[model samples]
Target: MILQSLVRLYDELSRQGKVAREGWGTAKVSHRLVLDEAGNLTGIVSARKKVLRGKKEKEIPSDMMVPLMVIRTTGVKANFLCDNSGYFLGVDKKGKPERTKECFEAARVLHHQILDGCHGAEAKAILSYFDRWHVDTARECPLIQENLEDILDGSNFLIQVGNRDATEIPEIRKAWDDYFKSAGEEGNEERGQCLITGKKDEPIAILHPKIKGVQGAQSSGANLVSFNKDKISFCSYGYDGEQGKNAPVSKEAANAYGTALNFLLADRTHAKVMGDTTVVYWSEHAKTVCQDCFLGMMGDDSGLTDKELDDILIHMKNGQSADVSGVTVSPDEPFYILGLAPNGARISVRFFLRNTFGTFIKNIAAHEERLKIVHPPWEKDWIPLWSVVKATANPHSKDSASSPLLAGSLLKAVFLDGRYPEALFQNILRRIFSDHDEPAGGGKPEMFKVSYVKAAMIKAYLLKNCGTKWEGKIQMAVNENCNDISYVLGRLFSVLENIQQSANPDINSTIKDRYFNSACATPAAVFPVLWKLANAHLGKLDQPRAVYFKKKLGLLMDKIAMPDRGTPLPHRLTLDEQGAFVLGYYQETQARYAGKKEDK
Candidate 1:
């Protein structure tokens, strides 16, 4: 019956184009079949094509492929499958193949062993023993020992018995439902709510609502009200006993008083919203005070009693203060209170105002600019160094040869920093120098001389200090610099390569003779070599030692050669006029010495 089922499944697979070539050759492919003690088939396993070797004469029954398909078809996470090769079989933590031929052959033997008995509960129990043993062997398979635990625990199994009446099993459904509902709840709670506004909505500003209350008795007092979003406006004009019994104050003072009142109202309203009660103490000549004796207060919430208010007022009155009005309250109204000064005392009221819209806007803009300046995420996507260099070299723009060099240097400092991959570095160099339309001229030679001098200096520094570890990186730097020079020259100059190889002899030897002759014969060539040596030496020394060598080299070069003029001189000679003059003197002396030796 098991063989019949296997044949039927293979036939269906062939009809669906899932199995290759429908004839006898198809069954010849090895299929990894998983079975229980009852000889019931559990799964089929296959291998992917990449792992398969030899001419594609016939596709193997892929153990890996079969399980992937089974997963899609059955919606189960408890099946096991493995390739036919012992090297790729699945196993349990104990390291044994779960579906070995020995286990299958034994189960087949047991199937016959149990067939003689009556097809009752006792026969089923005997068959179940074979199934359990098959699972145990897979868990302990030696071929997949390392991954045995994963196979046993990680893989899923599915039982698709047609007309088996599994619906009658209440325990299984309840267990499955409980597991899924717990998982669903966990997923939902992981996403939390917004904390600031206590709402799962977009960000919004918090505004304080104003309150209404009884107006004070002063004639100059006026009601305060919100005129627009985030703003409060009011007017104030009151009696001054000093001028006469009911003399009104100046319009300017009233307007100023009105403005002050608006600010005071906003402040008190905000304080109340923040759960702080306020007390207002009014003096004709003193600054405004809150209910808690908070004079010129901001953000303070400590409460004050009537006795404290009395003491504060007494102190103000002793300082020649006039009439005072005191009220203890929360920020409940848009009304203002005015105090009249008896006879000739001065009168003034002061209050805090909400920050202006323009001020807040300016603050926000400044903050945004600061954020952009500090964390510039856009810089990561900058064009490649070669592209930037080539663009800067175009004659159409106000670009020069030096522009590209500077641009390349900037790019090195900003992006590469010696960490970029080798392929990327090569790609950058190729892009920069691949297109060259200009004719090779004196400018080309001049640019080569300058670039070569700089490249040699860099090479010397790397070799003298970094040793073998620096070899690959230095070569890349040299190649990149050479590409840049090649673009400038409008043709390949093998001379730079020769100089580099001579400096590090293990490298390719193209222009070794030319480099040697130039170093021996010309001050221009020798200067770069010497400068590179000195600079490399200086870099490896202490600060004081570096300064000493730098000064000595400066003096030595000054006495040897004259500086190049009408163009930018080499970096070594450009350091100082004394150095160039010294180098010039040395060059002539060396030439005379060489001529004398030849004559001899």
Candidate 2:
């Protein structure tokens, strides 16, 4: 199903001239080998330019449309019109003279075979250069000697004639395309029914193109689909050790799907890396609006403005079509999202989800609604997906990464509107317990310990997955009128901490740093001690302020009614109760400082 969707996308992109044709693809060229009429090496001009990557500026190769390249592992394989210096100039930094000599010879033979009878100046100059160049004396050329270091860095090169690129010549393009069409006819290739296209007697691709840009995958690339026939379990009956034949995808279908995936991987607007997973998404009808809107919603850098995205989301919530960046996108258009993760030499499919674009938008909006909480003015109105997952990470850790598996699962749940993974909830709680005393900075007393994102996540999980126990109980802000036992205790803890902070204005540490975790887990034991401290703190306050605080404490304690067991506080709280305690504490703490300016 994934291949079928990608192939279909490739066809759509092809018709729109967004991707390469069947017999061609784009490659990164770092330099152009300038050649004269006599095929003499004249100059080596850089095909790369400096681009800003984060805070650093680095040189990146320019993308050029070139003939389709073959999948080469260690064995020698030469590409036409584009290749590293090893094949083009017969020299490299690897220091293997014999291997470099073989590379040059292979390129020479392949170019000669394709351009043998062509009379075009581009083709003739290319052939003449190959016949005249010598691997042993390549360094003798002043141009090659000057640029040897850069060329040997494995940067690709393209041939440039007087006013045009050699690859752009009509005759050479036709010759190369013709060669590509018939190259599969060579007897060495295995023929079978294509699993992707279902065409019989077609040449199957022994090796599919490499998928790049996936985090932690091979620097060169990794295979999304591959079969190891050496392992008997991977090979079917009668297939023997014919690797690709076991699942037979025709060379054309393989290239098509690969082209589509590579196109998405290369473009930022179509892909995003969350943790170790790289997510690529596309729309069925080839609309840029869908891509832009989706990326904007996921908090990726997109072309849409905040207002534009908000309007689109509002339309989606109303079940109406939206004009995104001046393009009207129907809600019924199919949208596909693919999650790819690195697994050694192969790419693992974390998820492949297909749904109406509107459905996805609605699911995202619903996720936002469920996570609604009273946030500080500094926080954005809508929390991004990355921020939600990042809440699970320990802020003090050097590598701020959550579980990769949990990241993927959390995204899938949000898109499908399913129950969030249990790990997400547990990890958030774990982070809260470990980071109990950490402050959100800016000298705000309410910003300590539990963050807004973590509190929101806990609230969302409990409301949706924890049944009717918490139904109609949780709210975006403090619920002053109502009281659950765990909640009242949590609110009381915040008031006690506030009293301590008020009494000792210069104190850096409060009871939260010492007793928050214990108070949350076993409120009965800690709250009594906190109450004794609160009384001493009250004595330090003025008469009016003391009376006000006492009244406030009495009101909250009155709400915690005693049951038949005659105990105001339970011995210990369960996991769900602990979450509610955190929520109550967060809400009440925010309430204490509501509408107040922070101390400068």
Candidate 3:
């Protein structure tokens, strides 16, 4: 089903003139080898394209063209009509003698094969150019040396018909197509009902191309499907090592899906690497709005402004969409989302969803609503999931990858409206226990470890369990009207901590530093002791501020009813209650800044 969706997308893309025609593959070209009608290498031209990344413009190899790669593991195997320095001229940076000689030979053989099919005068003249060709004279261009391995050995280079133009000749393309068709015939082709295309008597590719751009996969890439005898019991199924015989996929279907997926993976706007997984999305038809909006939510596209994306989301929240650049998104359009992760050589499907665009937006909007919280002034109106995940990771890295399973589960929950992964709540709690109130400064140790991102994640998790009655009570900021015992206790704890801070502004440690875990876990054990300490701290303050804070604490405490001052607290707070604790502390901190501004 995954491949089918991609195949259908490829077909639609072909119709829309966005992809190459059938039997051709898209390759990112760094430079082109320009050839004359006589097949002489006249000049080397760049195929570099410019694109804007963030606020800066940069150049990347992006002139996509049609070609088939010749992937020989160790030896030279030239492309049908295009290749990089390694295959065309054997220009290794280290100048390896054996590889250089071998690649030249491969090029010689490939051109001879092309010469054999040519009957015209141009073809014969091309053969003459090859006769006088010298591999020793071929020099590597400076562009090929930029990140040597990735450019010369890694990227695909192309062949153009002219010295400077990337345009192709009709006759050459037709001749190449004829040769390509004859070469694709695999002997002993499988004869069975194909699973994907449902055709019979068609060839099936046992080894498909390496799937690229997946995070943590093999550097060379990984396979989507394969079963070895050592790994699985049903390897051969009574056939002599005939791979992929059981789960039949026709060669046509295989190529179509592979090509389409590669197109998506190579495009940054369509693919997002979130920790262990790479997610790719597309609509079945020409719905640019759907693709852009979906990517916009995940913070993958750099072209759209934040407010523009946010406006689209807001309109979506209302079950309506505004026109965007002459194209308006409709909720009824079909959409597909696929998440893939690496498991050794084989690929793992984290999740796949097939639904209308409306359903996708609805589920996502609901999740955003759940995560709503008053953020710092510097924070963006919309938060990416990666930011939430990073708060749970070690603090040194600006871009820490979340756990693979956790990232997948969080995305699934966002798009499915299902229960969140169990690890998210537990991980947040673990961070809370180990962290302190460490405000950060230039290369200095933090004085407040509680971050807005982490607090927002805590709020989101708790709000998932918040019942309808607590709507107004559980809000973006401090909610004084809330009557929930856990929430009220959390708020009370915040006030007490603040009084300690007010009394000793320069103190290295406060009640929070010594008693935060205990305060949230077993409030009964910590609250009574903290209240006595608060009186001492308040007495150190001026008489006017002392009376004002005392009255505020007394009113908040009045809302908390207990049989007696010595009543025992619950042994430990549940996950939902833990969220309340975090939110109350976060809100209290924000209120402090607000009060200071008012005083000024």
- Per-candidate TM-scores read 0.17, 0.76, 0.75
Note the Cα lDDT for every prediction shown: 0.30, 0.87, 0.72
Whichever of 1 and 3 has more lDDT, that candidate is 3
For each predicted model, how many residue pairs clash, with residues at least 3 apart or on different chains? 51, 0, 9
Model 2 agreement with the true structure over 519-594: per-residue lDDT tens digits = 9999988888999999999999999989989998999989987778755788899988999999989998888777
> Residue 306 of candidate 3: its Cα lDDT?
71
Please state the error at residue 146 of candidate 1 in Å. 23
- Measured with C-alpha atoms, the lDDT of residue 183 in candidate 3 is 80
lDDT of 3: 0.72
Clashing pairs in 2: none
Q: Please list the residue runs of candidate 1 whose C-alpha ends up more than 4 Å from where it truly belongs after superposition.
A: 1-43, 48-386, 389-600
Q: Find the 10 residues in a row with the least total lDDT in model 3.
A: 162-171
lDDT of 2 at 406: 90
- Report the candidate with higher lDDT, 2 versus 3: 2
What is the lDDT, from 0 to 100, of the residue 196 in candidate 3?
81
Best by lDDT: 2
lDDT of 3 by residue, 387-457 (tens): 76666665655765666688888888888888677788778777787877766688865534567777777
